[model samples]
Target: MKRFITGQHVSLWRLTKRVTAQNPMMKYLIKKIPPYPTPVEFWVSNVAHVTDETGFKGILKSEQFRAPKSELSWWDLKIKKEEIRAAEKNYMKRNFSNKAKEPNEQKPFLETFTTSPLFQLKKSRYGNYRFTFPLAELMEWYKEQNCGGKEPVLRVYGTVTYKQQIVYTVLIHSPEDSERFGEYPLLEASEWVRYQDGKIIWKAQAICETHRYQFVSGEVQRLKTHLFYVWDQVSLVFHLPNRTKPCKAVKIPRQRLIEALEACKLDRKIDLLRYKSPKNKEERFFEAKMKVSELKRELEEEVKEEKSEAENDIKMEVDP
Candidate 1:
């Protein structure tokens, strides 16, 4: 009888365990606990109890805490649904708010322009000149052509102006070769303009002789008048009327005139060139002319000095 009674007690304990496992409330409680040890289950149970007593289904689903479905009444479930909707709306609002700022953000213009296909084409078409012969070959050819056997050192000074504004200036030096016939360094100048479509495009190109030539070994003869123009398969000469012959002066483009003005400023002192007699027009003109004459004289002196210095440098290099 004692053994039977012990068996019955054990059976009763097993039945109770099974019933608890099946109970919805117990299962919900277990579900509320995270895989890791956390306070989420305790908080959910407290919220569920409060919501049940207050008859507020919405309170259970509030951002403060979320109750298990088995513990929440029908009304509390409705509140949870509303909370989910509100959270979704808030997320959407945040996402859209971030997107709105992008249009106003500054972007890199140069990087985009350089990557564009049109820009690439423009660069390829005008950026470099194709020469048939190499410099060494050109030098040999010059020797064979009886071109004075003087090695020519060409110095090219380039200035680019756009819309009456000086944009760029560069000095390129190339030593002439006599080996290759008709071989010269390719010269290319390109100007970029931005379009309404946010695309950067090339506007115009002005090419000129790069002043690089091959001469035979002998006296270095400077070309009498260096040619300046836009050359590509054809040459367009830029004519500057003699400043001394004002009446015969060709209309100077505004861009060229501006460059000339800038050059003049750098050529001489500004204060000495300014007119002091503002009250008398004739006197101002006369004074201005005299100032110009003085500036000219100074320029000539400076040129002479430069020439002398260059000669001295060459002498030193040769002597040393």
Candidate 2:
């Protein structure tokens, strides 16, 4: 994920350099050009062809801001106006169109947007993942969660599922919020979290399916922006598990979504692998307890390794 920038923006030159560095042929081709690459040409030839999530495929990587106003490219101004027009058209369509508008063939221009959990993960033609969530519902949830009286701010965490399903899970609470949440796991994301539009956007570097293990490839924050939900096709999960036969997703009510959000908090304590039903309450509870114990042991061992007198870092190259 670090291959992508942690924040919305990063240097186009450096981003391209990383991929090209890995693929020597691309690097050599790029190096053939002097001083720096022609942004549009490089994007069209190589970046455009990269149909993966890690690459800056749907990103606003074209326009860059620099010292002088003259240094900034016209791309940003033109694209911004186009984006505003797209939004205006969408709003008009929603209000006036008789039928539900068809999904845009072009991916979203997400220069100003952030992560949202209300989306549905769907398989793409290229065996990748693309998702869509309602903007209106998300905004409502955000207000309900953050603006209401004495409501504890919801905390979100990202983790890879046991099957290596790369997903951002809303695990109960943050450590600082223990007074309200009770003592649990750190409840912290791998990196910082940015709460936006009711979703907690995490800048995490995990062992995802696509980008492999990004432990410490580089040491730049601006360049290390592997954000979730910022692009169209996300290839993070190698195997999206089949818990049951797939069914058409029903459009859930926004009110249900708000209720669902509340139920996932530390107060309700759901989806911690500890969720119980009417029939298997005791069995599931015990299973969750055992799993927690096992994870505690793993954590202990990790702490021990960290406390050792002096040890060299052992890097593992476990890629998908």
Q: What do the candidate models score in CA lDDT, each in turn?
A: 0.24, 0.26
Q: What is the lDDT of residue 160 in candidate 1?
A: 27
Model 1: how far residue 15 lies from native, Å: 99
lDDT of 2 by residue, 199-313 (tens): 3333322211122112122111132333221112111111111232441112334323222211011112123223224434344334434543454566567668786633433
**How accurate locally is residue 288 in candidate 2, as Cα lDDT from 0 to 100?**
35
Off by over 4 Å in 1: 1-278
**TM-score result, candidate 2:** 0.23
Local error of candidate 1 at residue 142 (angstroms): 39
lDDT of 1 by residue, 95-140 (tens): 3344322323412121111121111211211111111122233333
Leading candidate by TM-score: 2
Model 2: residues with Cα > 4 Å off, grouped in runs: 1-121, 124-152, 156-163, 166-168, 172-180, 184-192, 197-199, 204-320
Each model's backbone clash number: 24, 5
Q: In candidate 2, which residue pairs get closer than 3 Å at backbone N, Cα or C atoms, i.e. clash?
A: 4-225, 5-225, 5-226, 6-224, 6-225
